[model samples]
Each structure stands twice: as structure tokens, then as C-alpha cells.
Target: MLGQIDITRRQAEIADIVQRSGFASVEELAERFEVTAQTIRRDVNGLCELGILRRTHGGVEPPASAGNIHYSTRQILNLAQKKLIADLVAADVHDGQSLAFSIGTTPEIVMQALTGHEGLCVFTNNLNVAFTASANPSCQVTIAGGRLRPGDRDVVGRSAYDFFTHYKVDIGIFGVAGVDEEGTLLDFHEDEVSARQSILANCRKSFLVLDHSKFGRTAHVRGGHIRDVSCIYTDRPVPQHIQALLEGSETRVVAAQDTV
Candidate 1:
């Protein structure tokens, strides 16, 4: 029962749980507020339908979907810029190259730029990217085995982890939730971290593609530091101090602004 709680209050509570705990389990939630599991299920279902929550095995999580960038959101959100970066990155791919792609909006843009490629094997942890590219005859897309991630469009987990252990690729194109002088790449979800780590292991080179906004931001899970990367492509050049910190390391700072 709602117990006289206003709709706003209920929503506030839901938001609190998702933000603080990552996800809220159905059974625990049912008993916490004197409701049946079914009622809590319905509540969660309502939230999912409304795009406020994402359903996972035993609960709901925020940041809402594993493929956080929905098809609709991808259409309207910083799309032209993503396309620009994608076009540049796509130009770097040669025929018959083996590549691994991480799941992110920018990488998806990369896939779009590769619309007419042939004789290339593109391995991915992203179900969305895989689906988008699967129909193309010129490109072969492989989806690593894994558990599907919620609020994000990738498949991750043990199966995906194991598959990457034996496969090596020429490059891994990754995204970050944030980048810091500490050299760490961060993302909002731990599952995403695992997928990134696994992908990194299977690739000969790691390339991070992030927009200027992602710099200096903080995310909960750190994938690795810049020392672990071969290059980072961003919208603008990084500050000088930050460049010095990465000098003599594997990291090469490339700015799209310089190309323009």
C-alpha cells in the first residue's frame, strides 16, 4: 500500500535507493515497506516502463539501462560530434584487421562510420553495436559471450571474461566515464569495468575515445590509468601539466581539434 505517501515522495525514495546502492532487490524492498513482492514488482515494472529504472535479475538499477545510450537518445545527443570522431577513427582501420570494440556511444558512432567495410573481424561486448553491424556483409561482428548488462546495452560477466582470454585483437577502442591525472579510466558501473579490463587484455593496443566533457569527471569504477593506454583521442588537447604526467609512458595524447 502507498500508505498516504505522495507520488513524489515514492519517486524520491526510489531515486535514493538507486543512487546510493546501485540497485534495489525485490524481496528486500517488499518486506521493508510492508508490501507483497508482487506489489514491489509492479512498482519496479512501472518505473522501468517509465524509463526511470532498469530491471535486473533480482532488482532494479539506475543509470537505467546497460546500453545507457538508447537508440532514441543516440539520435539526439551530441550525435554530430560523435560522428566526427567516428569518421576519423574509421579512417584508421585497414582491411583484414582484427579489432575489439567496447560498448559506448562514441564507439557506436565508430560502427556507424564503418558501414561499408569488408574483410574485417570486429569483436565486441556491446550487443547494441553487434546488432547494428551484424547485417553488413563487408564486416563480420562477433559478440563475446557474457551476461547481459542492464542500463547499458552490452553483454558482460564470466562468459565474456573467458572468451577474451584466448582472443587477441589489433586494437581495442574504449570509452571512459572520466579521466584523471592519476591515469585511471573510470566508469559508472563495475560490470562495465570488468568488460573493459577483459577487452584490454585481448587487444594489442588500447585506444580511448572520449569527448572533452569526460575529462576531469569522476566515476565509481576505475578501469586503469593512462599508463595502461596507447593513446587517447579527445575533442581538445589536454592541459600541459597533464601531458607531462603522461610523458615517457605508453599514453599518446591526440586531439581532434588539432586535426580540424
Candidate 2:
């Protein structure tokens, strides 16, 4: 329960966190706004429902896309880092390459970076991704048809999955919510796992473009082991043990920011 003044202040505080940190947590927000955790939860729930902040487990991150693409309770996150990684991944693409891009912030960056590449084909379930790629004359892009997610411009569900079954690509690239000690990719939804599995099965090669913070973490659902991927592009030098596990599984780890 919160007094009117307290509630107003907390809401503004949550907005401030989203505006500044790009993400913030219930507990941290509670402490900052000098309110109870329950009050923060209420604010977060209400604000997310209102499209003021994106919410996530323990916190919130920025939406990958704005407008009709807002989904979940997660707040803003790691925009600069995501952009950096996107530029790096884009550099790997060339003319006449086909790529499968998934629905994630980093993938959005990759799409932006590829706007000028010629003769590129992009297959994506993310409407924004497909739209972004299509804008570049260099790309011939197709979107997977499915029920669109409210918060994300992703066309998830049966139709999209079925669409994926119809085509093969040179590479499938995506970012995961987490990476495990066993070197598996993990996420928050089973359908996403299923979609990625289909991508892995169909693509000639696959890539996991992740940031360092994702290493040694686990989300609610398991995507697959690292070896299931052809390569992992990341921004950090992985821990020795994680590096060894990746090597053991024959998954090449490419530090996206590495000068070499």
C-alpha cells in the first residue's frame, strides 16, 4: 500500500530508472523510491501494462522495438552494447548471403547494420527485422507468418514455425537469455526453443551472438547445448572453464569486439 504522494513518486522513479539505467529491478526501484517491494511490484505491473517500462525477471530491459512491439514487463537494457555487437556481426556478412535473424535486441542491431549490403536474403519471424531488411535494396527478405507477439514484432506460434520448415539458409543467428555451465543456450519460452531448434536443423551454419553478461547464466527454458551451434559470437573473454567447454564441444567462440 502506498500513499498517493508515495505512489506518484514511485511511478516517476521507475520511469527515471528506465530512462537512465535502461533497466531496473523491483527491489532496486523500491529502495530508490523509498517504498515497499509490494508497492514497487504494483507500479511495475501497472507501468508495464501501460507500456511505460519493459519488465523482466529481477528487473526490466529496453524493448527491442518501440510502438506496437512493446511486450513483457522487462525494462530497457544494454543499448550501446547491443549496438556494438550488431556492428561486429554485420561485418561478417557479405553480398549474396542468406541469414535467419531471430527476435532479439542484438539481432535488431544486426539488421540495422546490414542495410547497405547487396544481394542479401533475410528470413525472419520478427516483423521489424523483416521490414528493416526489406528497406535495404541489397536484401530480399521474407517474413515468417505467425501470430504476432504484442510486445515484440516477432511472428511466433504455429504459422511462423511452419514457415521456417519451408526454407533453408546460410546461417541462423540469435541471442539467448542465458548460457549455462554445460554451454547450452537458454531462454524464457519453449516456443522460442522450438523455433531455434528448427533454425539449427535447417541452416548450413548457425551463430549465437551474445554479450558477456549472458555467460554462466540460466533462464527458465533450455534452448540447446553450445555444440549445437556452429559458432558463438560474444563480446567478452569467456572464463577459462567456459572456454574449455566450448572448445570441447567444437563450438568456436568469436569475441565480436576483438580486434583480430
RMSD of each: 11.3, 8.6
Model 1, span 1-260: residue lDDT tens = 10111234444455456645888898888777678889788777766675566888888886455523343333223445566767767777777788788877778777777767777788888776776677678778888775776545677777766766767998888887777766577887777788789888889888887776667777767788766878777777876766877888867777778888
List model 2 lDDT by residue over 102-174, tens digit each: 8776776678778888999898887767877877776898888768875566877777667777888998988
Candidate 2: Cα lDDT at 24:
84
User: How much is 140 displaced in model 1, in angstroms?
Assistant: 1.7
lDDT of each: 0.71, 0.72
Could you give me the TM-score of model 1 versus the true structure?
Answer: 0.70
| Model 1 CA deviation exceeding 4 Å by range | 1-75
Off by over 4 Å in 2: 1-76
